[model samples]
Target: MHRNQGLYNYLNEHSWQITEDWYKLVNDEDSESIYSTTDPEIIQSLKEQNQDYFQHLHKLFIEKEEDFFRDFKIWSEELAKDQKHLKTPVQYVVREFMNSQEVYMKYLKEYFSLNKDNVALDQFLSWIDLVRRVVNLSIYIYIEEANRNTLRQLIAQKEIINELSSPVILLRKKIALLPLIGDIDTARAKIILENTLSQCADLRIEDLCIDLSGVAIIDTMVAHEIFHLIQALKLIGVRSTLCGIRPEIAQTAIQLGLDFSHIRTTATLSQALDRIIAD
Candidate 1:
């Protein structure tokens, strides 16, 4: 039982005591019998209610604390496995949080820190907010990595297309060799040009061998794009060499009056490689 005088003194600084009428917890329900009793019963009843409220509050505070650590533990484990999934700023924030000595230090400290001298309830609440941010940051990184993996799969597909662009006895310089497969249409041509040009530029390669070995037809647009890429390469100081143009491409080239004079032509990738290697 809280002594009326003592309980009042102990809770003198507490806002709950001042705002006693505001609480449904303490004032809720029929406490009239308890509130009405004289002497020891009234005081005892109020103390019991106070104690019960304190007990419930204390338990909730403890559970909240445990829950904070629980969230932190799960976040830490996942963060350890996937840090890149975290926000760039949050990484530093977490590092500071973990390195705090007055806070949860060591590995925990390195992840987060708080100054002990300024330990206040508000500060503790802020720390929890930061902890939640770190967890969210880790989740973001995980999603980013997952998205990147999917993109990589698509990139691998492009790489495969590049390989087929040219038929070769050998592959060199990480060129996106595209041996034309299936439909050799205008759409395919555009994709090839864009992909090839992008790879060549990104790689900063001087020599690109585009072998039309598998092209079903030597269409007007395909020839135009090939020459276009060749010119783009020259402008960028990259040299594009055509290889594996069967009789069909030659005939089409002649028929279209397409000038192959500025472009180097090779019968096969082997010949192109040999010439490039020689140069």
Candidate 2:
């Protein structure tokens, strides 16, 4: 109540103008309230009170923003624990909220105690609604990424699932070492191709080493798809050298009568690295 009296004083002093939010808080609702009904003595007192309110509220926000995040981190964690166990970064939460272009005109009006005017309040309310939507979208992104990561883990758990090596860089070159861990279908192969190609442009990578030591088998169609990826990379100025081909996988290539068709094949990553270095 005292704080309100202080804010009222401050608003009255400025003719209801809110400087920070550019809102004429005092004059926004009614100038008559201060000068028409109230005496000059009462108006003078209100000004003094509002000055105190401004100082206190400014201090409060400075203190509270830090605490709000700390509390939010704790609260979000608690909420996540009771849910399906999806944990997201608090950084994401705060960033999404802070950068969210949502400014609450309504919140400003309410904070200023200009509640009687619905038209002015609507503008602020609309701003709040916009920010809320942006925050929700940001959250969705975090949740989706978390779920994708979980799915990737599950897939990697099966012994039959082959793990592809991440693209290793060498000699200012991108050597995509697809050391097949388990299996290679058109789908996984497509993912590997996309991942490797994505790195090529950024890294200015020249050599791509597609290793297949952990992979034991490949159908003719898969082989053709691999050939296509190499060709595509070659067209984009990325030289692909398929490395770490286990003997069994080589035999599959031979038994299936799969022609590599200009795709460079190597026995090991060491050999591939050495060759790229020599080049």
Model 1 TM-score (2 dp): 0.38
lDDT of 1 at 7: 24
lDDT of 1 at 24: 24
Model 1 per-residue lDDT tens digits across residues 1-279: 111232223333342432333222222232223333346764555454433333322222234556644654454455434333232333343332233212221222222233344344454455455444544554455455555656777898976775566332225664435455554665556666676666677776777777677676766777777777677667867777888888976888898887888788899888888888888
Off by over 4 Å in 2: 1-176
Summing lDDT over every window of 10 consecutive residues in candidate 1, give the lowest-scoring window.
101-110
lDDT of 2 by residue, 239-273 (tens): 88888877887788888898875677677888888
The true-versus-predicted C-alpha distance at residue 77 of model 2, in Å, is: 21
Error at 59, model 2, angstroms: 45
Error of 2 at 29 (Å): 60
